[model samples]
Target: MTRWRFAQGVAALAAVLLLVALWAGAPEAPEAPIEALPIADVVSERLTTLGSVVGLAGSGDSHAWLGIPFAAPPAGELRWRPPRRPEPWTDTFDALAYGSPCVQLASGFGGVSDQDPGSFAGDEDCLYLNIWSPRFDAAEVPTGDDRMPVMVWIHGGGNTIGYAGSFYEGSLLATRHRVVVVSVNYRLGALGWLAHPALLAGAEEGEPKSGNFGTLDLIAALGWVGENIEFFGGDPDSVTIFGESAGGKNVLSLLASPMAAGLFHRAIVQSGAVDTVSLASAVNYTDEEPPGDSFSAKEVVLRLLIRDGSASDRASARFFAEGLEDSEIAAYLRRKTAEEILSAYRDEPDSADIRPPRVIRDGVVLPHRRLLDLFAEPGAFRGVPIILGSNRDEIKLFLSQDPAWVSRSLGVVTRVRDGARYNFVSGMHSDLWKVWGVDEPAAALSRSQEAGVYAYRFDWDEEPVRMGTDLGMLLGAAHGLEIPFVFGHFRFGDEATAKLIFDEADEPGRRFISDAMMSYWAEFAYAGTPGRGRSGGLPEWSAWGSDVGQFLVFDTAADGGIRMSTDTLSTQGLLARLEGDTNLDQTEKCELYRDLFEGSADWNQATYSGLGDRGCPPESLNTARSD
Candidate 1:
């Protein structure tokens, strides 16, 4: 290991050794006091938000506190309702290990949630947030000048499943960028976001009666941060919101949500878009079936559950009481298994009334329809600066076929026993469809408020994730690949492409790029622009659409990383097919377009789930070759 890496190892070892005394009420060691090492200092702390917050404060120019619950557990009767303020406690709650992730089916989530095999399990009490704030310099204090910018994070799992523990560590960004960082967890799956007519009718003032309940949880956390971050020495007004994948989508949602206005000043969205759920769907929220012929969130859950096994009151009761343990719940779950319990819920009387009918046009929270449509209409948000990009091989996580089959499968087509034929595939999978909009994020942002937009493409993957094949070979900086580079985490890309994906020339490569990222992010937080007027030796990035075809490629290759095009986005084409003016509604349109999807005779659904045309067609002025 390099000297810095060795230092890291030693620091971690020391941290492990020191954690014993940091535990609340634990005895301090009797060893003689030694001078502080190069490592940062962290301490345990209890903060009061909706409830008593047990948090840890790490030292540096900044400090971080981990795992503070922002909302009440979604247990029992509260399962489908919007999250409430966690019940207050008289004692300090221990914010030690990241709390359990909310209970989710784990069907679609891959990278956004914990990718670790041995740590962090998904649970009911998963509505917590983690905070990282740079130290307040005495100069910035009221009498002392002590203040730094803050950036809060919201993890993404399609408003279903994700946690605050993985894929993000605010230390590097916090101290290096001289800013505060925060990551949070929210409700997910059937428990976190279930919008029903009955629930809507019961909506009280200040509560999100319909549409997005999980979104409300995020708002509450922001509110909590606004109130408490000052205690940790952060500037409350100059906050930025950022995340990757689903978390990016959450940030955008917050931007439009009335409840989230003024909570953040700047934003960074890595691979998130608005065209995810078509505006057409049906539900069984009431006694009878919903009045549409389209597939709805509620209907999808009901059918999936019934198919999964929820067939009667016992099953229904089990599914409803899933993870709801004042006591005995864990035993029941252990006895039945998660699948069996979920199956039982499906078998219930109104399983169809479970989740959101659809992420419909909520004028209050979303403030607009079709994410880009609002940009077209203008005034969708506070018009803050945004740093948005996607990985070159973002589709890597979606590589489903065993690696052994990759080479042969690349250009050839085959028919399976299910009478399904696989075509030459390229891109992500259906599960990705569960969370991300198929539209290229670049295309989506082109039509949005475009002033502060910064875009990038991630194209790196180090090791192959395929259990049976070198699937990574096919994924060139696939989805979310740019994240590590942006955050200065280089392990996310391919060993072959690392230098190309990021500046890998030396320690300065990591430090410089990280510095650039931090400065730009901090600059955005400070003054709606990156770098705080300092270039950080990085190239300038420009906005897209309406001509001026300019972009800053993030690759380290001496290609100047500059490209321009206004014709790569075919969002209109994709939307037209997904939700068109035809008499057919979106689901019907999709059903009709089924011939063009995965198992169809001519198309490759596994990797390339797009219109026959790719992004950025030179022939079209409004599209690009990448689109």
Candidate 2:
């Protein structure tokens, strides 16, 4: 009788276990095949306003339509002008490959390159966009309430480099999250942001003359999405624009731009700051009394004329350039090859990188007011929900390559020369970045806009120790490192580069964090608030509040997992912290202060002068460092 009772108890326990398993449920299955959707047949063709486009198969049950022109090529006569709608075509367009990247001097770090670094790559006619969506049949395309939210990605390279290349492929994000992903290419460098008066001599009356042609390119791309995203199973009314670094800066520009209003519903800026060029800085000669940018339109023209043997020296070149009529100057500039025009503005004598003034505040495209001021004023800028974020060690990416802070072996392996000094400088700079890019902006937007303003600090730094190098300590949540995690892509550059930063041992934690980030991003796109993420199972991400230091910290379980924190940063607070530190001498402190003051938007001469009277001149600060 006891044995019989035991058997019955065991059966009851088994039943309960089965019930629990049913309630908990299993993981979502891999993406469904096209045939599984409620459609008559699979169709990879999409009819757009420009033409009918056929897409190719993409990773993980997604379809990709690449090289679709949204605007007329901004080349020759169209250069430096607002983008116009592309001429329509009758034949079916094969959008199987990406368009040429916008013209830029190649950099192995961010810019596109097939040749050696510093060599020029890409083309003048590169106003195209790529789209990725879940594979669907023609008859089963989602419409009306079922249409998915759309996300448009803007690549970052200081607005001078980068392209919508394969490195940022959107298949994983789109397929996994059930959202439409679009990546765009815009004009870069001087070809996109020149503000010479000669180019505007015969401009039409209502045309934007702000010399922010790159900004206009984004506006035009959003316009395209608004008109035609429905054909790709996306809702036109629910568009979110997101970017990193300079791309994030562009997102902020769109928020400030009256021309870009109503084009996007939400925005996400990852490590982006507010910086705009003045009209004088964009057009004046560097030698003028108030002196313009070293690579201003006039300065570049002078250099080009000298390089062409039309003038012997700076004084003579300026004289020759000033002698030309407006029409003559316009004709002369147009006659120069793209290479000649680009090479004239190299950042260094031997480097092909050019850092010219961009996003001009010409009182038309962008308001004359500053971004923070505009955000503080109700209704002055777009009131959409915004997510502002920065990495924990934002400066480590650049500093890791600097010879002053680190030593490299064979130009591949690297080690920090002075760990304490390296951490101190990187931490301070990174904190300042948060002050400018995330905290300050979040506070301003929260005060002005009714929509939710969210803030985040990405703290996932799990790089492996390879070749006696501790990558985690060296890079540690560095700038641009969060990009792949956001997109669920781990592969960047060759296998060696990928292996150096990511290790198979860390895969489980890396994927967990990536999944959490994507969930938060997609949820925000869907409802303008990340809330408890898509599943409503993660930690709640509260919007910015009146209290201090409210933000979601993204990390893995091994490193505290996803949680909220109350740690905040400010210019005054950072200054105080720096003053109290005993790790560095007065000279070092002043040098660091110089860099901070130069980078800070709240530059105050009085505050800088009060720093120990260490003889640090505020004039020594490089105002062009942000570029």
Candidate 3:
């Protein structure tokens, strides 16, 4: 779109929005006394740190500060380095439009991809953040007596895709919950993650030299929020960090990172699993890929050099790779454009094959131990109140998109019927998530901080998917289904997916679930306990403990809405039930056990041994195990 047309669109949107703000009794931008000067057309506000005004545009009840820079653009020589503070400007900087997402693949491969219309297809200078607040006018800015809670959202795209702007519109949470919502944009793909000896050559002696530049970007945004949110009428001391999927995993990382202490007061993880790699694994290319090498920063640099005709053969490439000085290699790597480095990982046939471990166990930012091990240690976490949970059918999103890939990833080659495959995949991922992602971590946190950890399961399956089959049956409570509900954004993304996932038929359940979630999440941000100050008749959510693995199940049932339940359906207990069911022959039982749990990391050796004593057939179990 042309600049003229874009400006016209902005004016039209702002004009329509003004009517809503007026109806909502939102204050006009102040003017008169210099301190009370109000912004016009698109409502705007000035932050305390920069003292530069930013225009707000979006739906009326709230003002949106889109594409606000938190750090200097990490491009050119700054490509692989930690974010530097953005340069201050003397004049108002227009934050009227959404910023481009960090450079990433256009489609889903390793994780969910952001395909929004203005994800502007991707860029290198994407360290921007967006905010949605109910009060943005100078007159509405809060004084010492009345400050709103702040929620900083980290969007999930497997740490490879997604941006801060369009997909995660925060109006509903801001308006309905009376909180300030900030969604952040961080670096993605190889540009955000490539750590090498050369890349860290000139680093300060004792600093973190790991590749998790994406994690650093997030830390920078949090630092920015803690400093400037008060200018937007948000209480900086009451900040809550929340995310889903990869974003959720990031929340876990922040909790475990020593550098992140005091940045956020609360954290919530939804379907987030943590995986860390050692510096040895990242730089060595020891795992398998093409040419008998792992997909790492070394391979990416080699590809760029070969593509540019700097080195014609693998031998010469190896010569420069191993023989060159660390500073020399760092300089050469920094000189390459963002695209040249990212192109190496962009060509895999499927996302499943190429998802190399990205979060590293660097000593400075992250500890050397695995995340789960760290969670188990006393006081290892930031000692903050936390909420963690998963969907009932987390794997359905993957199965619906590509069953073959889902099956392979699930480690199943059984020729079971489609219905059975669906049941197996969904049940397997859901149970495993509860065991590892939710319950275990909650149990650990509970031991450290009593009544400080909460767990939940989103089971609302009334999505109005327009696909041929009933969406409730096909998608169920799938991965990311909880996100739109949390944000109260029933319509998601560009076109058909929104209509398919939520339509008139799904309004009642959507409204009910969204209201409850917003109330629960926002209340936690306010009082550090969900049930403390809520007047909305929300269910009393209990905390999870080692012995008591309680969770608030979010579903729209005929009898009651949200209810607290115990962990009766433990992974081992569920497998035992499948084994003891007389209706299923030995073949089905063994196949179900092996397909659903055997090869998974969540598998319990003790439970498997008990099942063997329960007369599960040796042959069927053996066959499924062989693959």
TM-score of 2: 0.90
Against the reference, the lDDT scores of all candidates come to: 0.48, 0.80, 0.69
The candidate 1 region of ten consecutive residues with least summed lDDT is: 1-10
Per residue, candidate 2 scores C-alpha lDDT tens digits across 327-394 of 88888888887777778877566774566446888788889877877898988887999999999998
The superposed Cα distance between candidate 3 and the true structure at residue 521, in angstroms, equals: 0.9
Q: Candidate 3, which ten residues in sequence have the lowest lDDT sum?
A: 2-11
Tens digits of per-residue lDDT, candidate 3, 1-627, equal 111111011112122122223333445544435554324334456655865757565576788788888999988777788888898888778777777778764543212233432122478888999888884567768867588999999987667666675668898789877899999988886777777778877666654666788899999999999999888888989999999877888899988888889999999898887656665556664433322225666766676677788789756777667778888888887777665555556444333212423577767678878887788778766679999999888766545544342222233221213665467546765676677678777877888764388989988888542323445755678777788788877545433335444678768877888888888999998888887225548779888867778999898865356898895356766676665555556555555566566534545555554563354544433221110
- Structural similarity to truth (TM-score) of each candidate: 0.65, 0.90, 0.82
Ranking by lDDT: 2, 3, 1
RMSD of each: 12.4, 12.9, 10.0
lDDT of 1 by residue, 1-627 (tens): 111111010011111112212322234434555845333233434345544443444544555566677778866556555777777777766655556666544321222222332122466667878776554432342212456677887665444344666456676677666666788877654444444344455556776665476777788788877877765656788788887666777777666666788887788876665533322222332233323212343444444444546434434633654334423432332343333334333324433111212244555556535555554445655666676665544433333222322333332311111111111122212212212332343344555665556555443334332223232353344554445555545542123233222333334434544455566666676666653324445555456444433344444333333333232333234444344234433343333344223222223232233433332122212111110
**On TM-score, who's better, 2 or 3?**
2
Task: Provide the clash count, candidate 3.
Answer: 2
